[model samples]
Target: MSTVKEAVDVEVPLHTAYNQWTQFEDFPNFMEGVEEVRQLDDRHNHWTTSIGGVRREFDTEIVDQLPDDRITWRTTDGDTRQRGTVRFESLDDAHTRVELTMDVEPSGLVEKGADALGMIDRRVKGDLRRFKEFIERRGTESGAWRGRVRPGDPGGGLI
Candidate 1:
């Protein structure tokens, strides 16, 4: 698996950032190449995406989640297998740090080449930057959830 790690500081409270993130459908608004993300249930989703010019579909199972803290997911079906987690860190009352780590297997030579050259990392970083801008401009969360999961427990199984 090839991994990419990126983070950005957002001008929003930790809860705002974390809550907005739970709105899976909103991802495509800021995330590049994420054509669609439909939350089938609290712990399951169907995703359609095009990365490195290759279109792919997958069903992801959220193996663990902790509201306003972190989320973990794994692919259940697809040409590629991926697992990742996103964490929210509070910088202060009005600012939060969002970090993401993803491990992926490229589906083809071109995709592999792009990964080797760090293009994927750049792309993911860009996505985070855009998300930061989008959220900060609004100055309030688009939505929110009060759920909380302690560090060790899997809050929900796949979402």
Candidate 2:
């Protein structure tokens, strides 16, 4: 397994940053390799992405979530094996720091090679930088889901 961590500070309130992140389907707007994301439900999402010339489709389930704080997810099915968390921290009323940590298991030679070259880290850093620009330009979230998901809650507490 390989891990990549990246962070960026956005010029928005904690809630604004957090809320925008909750709109998973909007990820493609800022995420480089993500082609599309479909929110199956509050806690489930289907993703299509092309990285390193490889296209993959995956399903991910949110495992834990706390409004305006953090969200954690794991890939449930697909060609990818990974888990990650995105956390939001308030720097002040007008600034929020968003941090992302991801653990990925390379299943084949291509993925392993990409990992060895620090491609994942660069991709993550670029994504975060784009996210900062995206949210800052918008100045508000398109939508938000404030529901809390506890550790043992089914479906990550969609309700």
Candidate 3:
């Protein structure tokens, strides 16, 4: 397993940043290599991505979430095995710090090589940078889901 951590400071309120993140389907707009994301439910998402010429489809489940604080997810079924979390912290009323930490398992030599070369790390950093630009330019979320998800929640969100 390889881990990557990145953070960015955006000139938006914490809720703005956090809300934008909850709109999973919009990730393709700012997340490079992500082709599509479909929200199956509040806690389930289907993702299609092409990275380094490799196309993959995956089902991911949100494990825990807290409005304006953090969201965590793990791959449920697919060609990818990974887990990650994104956290939002208020720098001030008009500034937010977004942090992401991911753990990925490389399936083959090509992926392992890329991971060793720091490609994954760079990708994550670039993604965060793009997210910063995207949210800052919009100044508001395209959509949002404010339901809370605590540990042990059956569906990963408060109903």
Candidate 1 or 2, higher lDDT?
Answer: 2
* Per-candidate TM-score against the hidden true structure: 0.89, 0.96, 0.96
Error of 1 at 81 (Å): 1.2
Compared to the true structure, candidate 3 yields what TM-score? 0.96
lDDT of candidates 1 onward, in order: 0.85, 0.92, 0.92
- Cα error, candidate 2, residue 32 (Å): 0.9
Stretches of candidate 3 off by over 4 Å are: 155-159
Estimate the lDDT of model 3: 0.92
Could you give candidate 2's per-residue lDDT for residues 1-159 as a string of tens digits?
899999999999999999999999999999998999999998899999988788999999999999999999999889899998999999999999999999999878998998999988998999999999999999999999999877668665221
lDDT of 3 at 65: 90
- In model 2, what is the error at residue 23, expressed in angstroms? 0.5
**Which lDDT tens digits does candidate 3 get at residues 1-159?**
899999999999999999999999999989999999999998899999999899999999998998999999999889899999999999999999999999999887888999999999999999999999999999999999999877678755321
Model 2, which residues run further than 4 Å from truth? 156-159
Candidate 1 per-residue lDDT over residues 6-94, each given as its tens digit: 99999999989988988888889899999999989777789999876689899887776788889888888878688899999999999
RMSD of each: 2.8, 2.4, 2.5
